[model samples]
Target: MRKTVRVAAIQAEPKWLRLSEGVEQVVELIGAAAASGARLVAFPETFLPGYPWWRWVDSNQWNVEYSTRCRENSMTRDGLEMRRITGAARDHGVHVVLGFGERQDRRIYMAQAVIDENGEIVSVRRKAGLNPIERKVFASGTPNLPAVRHGVIGRVGALSGQENQRPLLTRALRADEEQIHIAAWPGNPEGEAAGPDSAATVSRMYALEANAYVVAPCAVVGAAAWDRRGPQTGRGSGQARIYAAGGAEVVTPLAAGAEGILYADLEIGSAASDRREVELAARPRMRRGQQQAARTATPRRLGADRWAVPLMLGSGPGGLAAC
Candidate 1:
């Protein structure tokens, strides 16, 4: 594996339910990242069709309206929209880790896809754990899916927002010997995850525990985008940041939200060395029974299998938490 590799994380407003437009925007970002010399590029969770900020809002009407549109705009794994993205990766000569709503049959899962520079759609992992409200919109997939794999830069992997908090999921990723892990999030407050200084703590720990560099890109909710004008920065919105193995802070292009790409040159040798020291031992700790228990208990935990995501109406947007 190469000792150094360049990566990029995108922090921008989503295309918002425009499937073809979303593909174009992704292609643009890929080209820009490749031009900037990034070997790997990552985006925030559900970035293509946009994050369901409405689900976090209390307005059932908006949630109902938006959820349907989001599903309709969601891309299928084998669809032309995805092919365009893969083609962009191939043309740009960069590995892409992207988050999108994956339409499969009648269900939509919060999904992440890893595409290699050769245009091969290598892995598509769905979100396995959903919070109560998230269950209202997206379907949970099988947990602890394979995330680590050989790619352009080296062994790479990706995960959606809350999955970073899931012990089993992260453990599985670590056991897989991931070198660069994309910690994708829809968007969260800066000072979160144990309430340190910034949300970096969440990813910092993830980097340390997984023995990998962390590329955490977050989504931004544009105030005008609510009305479909353009993406304007909001207060305390997310940043595109990266952390080195063992929690060393790297470059961050946008620290306080807006539109930009975060880039970092990582020394992957440390992660490779760490994995060599731990992967075997960690694999033994991952019990098949543990996954079985979670799967068996999921139905009760997520409530009756509602085919459509419910919009648990509340007082207002201010009443519910977005991200």
Candidate 2:
């Protein structure tokens, strides 16, 4: 049997201060994707209402309490609207991964909720860290976050905003054999100005290093979108791409920064085949052995011990320069 699944990435505008409107938009988008025969769909970061870039636009200029109220109003996890969205996913038999504002214990968080085909929430991840403007509105995630398997499809992990650029975090998560990696970009109105290259490269590198597939669904931002809307929103340019195993981009929906659904068919077996080939490679195994040998042969040194030799040797003409 062919191991295949159709996935979709949606890029669209979300109405601020109107979460009901946003959820309805998401349901509409998910319905469209299900009609296109997608089994899974993912949305951009903070898709509920909108991303909170306005927190940076001088909150002092506005009523401080009201700005806080606005953020608090947008944060939600379980409600009638959430149940409706999840029910739609269940009814359509489409697994949904969506970013939303999460309100928990008097704290607002940048969170993504993964709902399985049964309309059940499999995992909820709070953004591990906060960005510049985010610090004003949201809190941080705990340390236990990494890729977690939702159901039978694959292991899923989330990277919000610049967290995509953190190499160590990616490696740690990818090391565990994550099959589907989701990078949720906080969209701005400045087009690709907010590290679009880094966004693409992060997904590509994760796919290659993890020997798995990466689904990068970004927020759409553009000059006109910003000017017409307001400077409070940086941009709304969406770019959703899929990188196959071994760093090959299998399919990319052509419309960049536009509001639409980008679809791709994923083959999980391809990732396994790629990793088995690399694991069987002589160079890779030899590199591992070399690392082990170096670790064993190297002397155990503390701070002063490590510098002593270099410092003593540097004092002489033939000595090596201290690190």
65-101 in candidate 2: lDDT tens per residue?
5346556566567877788899999999988989888
Candidates' lDDT values, in order?
A: 0.76, 0.68
Name the candidate that leads on TM-score. Answer: 1
- State the lDDT of candidate 1 residue by residue for 12-87, as single tens digits: 8788788789889999999999999999989889897987766656778877887888889998999999999999
Where is model 2 poorest over a 10-residue stretch in terms of lDDT?
A: 305-314
Candidate 1 has an lDDT of 0.76
Q: Report RMSD (Å) for each prediction in the order shown.
A: 10.1, 7.5
- TM-score, predicted candidate 1 vs. hidden true structure: 0.80
Off by over 4 Å in 2: 63-66, 194-197, 222-229, 232-236, 280-323
